[model samples]
Target: MENKKAIKLIDKILENLDATGINTDALIDDIKELRTYALEQQVPLVVKVLRLTYEHIEANQSFLIPILEDENDEELAEAQEVESTPVESLKYLIALTRNLNNKMNISDLREYKELLMAY
Candidate 1:
């Protein structure tokens, strides 16, 4: 349930990015690349969040190293990073979900992503 909520939250962040004018095409490419990487390594979604979380932390100008730090902190940092995207990063969210590890339902996933990206 928590991971589901977090995923939705990421969708909202992406939406905001779009609204703000981020280069979504590039974001999509990045997500696709990430997904491919995840598949190749058989990594789970939570760990996939590792890259996004790291990106967010660096953007925040924090001095902490992702691999050496806390999980909760990483998740929150990734959530906050979602706020920095241009207008809406909805596409990125879609890409991430499409690459999920089969732990959650797709319908529920879309609903939250839609709701969060609504604004």
Candidate 2:
């Protein structure tokens, strides 16, 4: 798939992930579609990150929500926004896709992928 199409798909997936109430079923479908695009583009890092993201959400159904809810608590109000971690990671993936010519972005992508895998 073209880079433009892949970026758009990634944006859509990010939108779904960042929504108020996440729908795991729909999110999984989007991830699978994005993974197919990554595979076609022959980008192994993108493919691996997408795969790990899929498995993480699959195993932890409410992974994003708890952090979000905690962020709403008064005690955590002063804390940095940890809830956006996953969303930020996806945004990095989007950045990586958009700037494939830039070798430096690959490190960010790899780092995010490692974080996801370690989670």
Candidate 3:
């Protein structure tokens, strides 16, 4: 049952990626670091799905070009605000993971969640 839910989550992530062209190499690196923490803390399954989703996005770099190119453009800030970025997607995943894993009392996880929220 959990595996089914994980698969559905991945599908939804991919769907959102297709609908919105937003992602970044920095976001992917951050997600990889997050996954490493998840693995060390025994939450491999959840982070693995997230890792796969980001890997898919990494493969589709063309879709991310516009967003990456405009990342520093002050004029694009307002337009970008309305669309979901990779970091925002990761935050939602982190929150969902926190809810799903009742045993998650990791202090680092809590700190990371706060940091992401702050960003």
- Maximum-lDDT candidate: 2
TM-score of candidate 3 on Cα atoms, chains taken together: 0.40
Q: Which ten residues in a row have the lowest lDDT in candidate 3?
A: 62-71
Q: Quote the lDDT for 109 in model 3.
A: 42
**Root-mean-square deviation of every model:** 13.7, 6.3, 13.6
Model 3 Cα lDDT, one tens digit per residue, 1-119? 13444445444444544555354665465456555655655775656555664565577652221122134676666565655465454444444554444544234344334433343
Error of 2 at 49 (Å): 0.7
Q: Distance (Å) between predicted and true CA of 43, model 3?
A: 1.5
Ranking by TM-score: 2, 3, 1
lDDT of 2 by residue, 26-86 (tens): 8777778888888988989978977876777788763432122233466564352554565
The parts of candidate 2 lying over 4 Å away from their true place are 62-95
Assess each prediction's global lDDT (C-alpha) against the native.
Answer: 0.43, 0.65, 0.48
Report the lDDT of model 2 for residue 72: 44
Instruction: Report the C-alpha lDDT of model 1 over 1-119, residue by residue, as the tens digit.
Output: 13454455456545545564344444444445544544555655433453453354345433121111124587766765755342323343343454455544344344433333332
Which candidate comes out best when scored by TM-score?
Answer: 2
How well does candidate 2 score on lDDT at residue 101? 60
